[model samples]
Target: MFEPGRLHLEHSPVQPPDVAYELIITYAPASSQDGPSMHFQVTGHIAGQPVDESFDLAADLAFNFASSIDHLARRHGLPATQVVPISLHRQYDEMFADIQHKLGRHCGDPVDARHLGKT
Candidate 1:
């Protein structure tokens, strides 16, 4: 399920029968000396393990969070091809636009090289 600033994913695998988990991601706009960015908090469990992590994404790159979600899912033992299952693309687009508006970011905006892990 997806809401403006949050997304929740749940999975129950049949192979392990006992395997089940949920992942929730919440994000908001933040600013540091480096500039504006998006702060994200991921909380939930994978199978029987608890998961709690946080990270920040440069505003210009925040829309790519789906890729990050895929990474997190894999790290938690989900299949490599598993990703956010958003049945409505329009909802994702709305969330993207909302984040962009909150961060005042637009296409072609300059991205900090440091945030890109270049330096």
Candidate 2:
């Protein structure tokens, strides 16, 4: 559930990926803070709700998104799944974690969520 900077890609030929998509590995420089925080955020339709997040550079935040989607797909019997690259808007580590907490779920492990292949 993310769309990269619409302006950033305006001049580029490739169109953005679809929702529940994954962008190729790309990085936006940290902001001008003393040491700007690095993060991963998701904003768009996901798992029956909108999702957004930010995380430290090393936290593999992207992986979490994919895992979460995977679980949801399995649970809901979606026909397909994909990973779209993400966009950044400066640093907001606390905000990202907050959103995750509000979701009250971690898209980790799927063995139990998928029963009889029907989530």
Question: Once superposed on the true structure, which residue ranges of model 1 sit more than 4 Å away at CA?
Answer: 14-19, 86-90
Give the per-residue lDDT of model 2 (tens digit) for 1-119.
Answer: 22231111111124343233222222232332323323433333433443333333322232233344344434433234332211242222333444344333245623233222221
Q: Write the per-residue lDDT of candidate 1 for residues 22-119, one digit (tens) a residue.
A: 88888899986676788888899876788898778777778777667667766876654444454344467777777788898887877666677511
> Residue 23 of candidate 1: its Cα lDDT?
82
Best by TM-score: 1
Lowest summed lDDT across 10 adjacent residues in model 1 is found at 80-89
Instruction: Give the TM-score (vs. native) of candidate 1.
Output: 0.76
Q: Each prediction's TM-score against the native? A: 0.76, 0.25
How much is the lDDT of residue 27 in candidate 1?
89
- Model 2: residue 86 alpha-carbon error in angstroms: 7.2
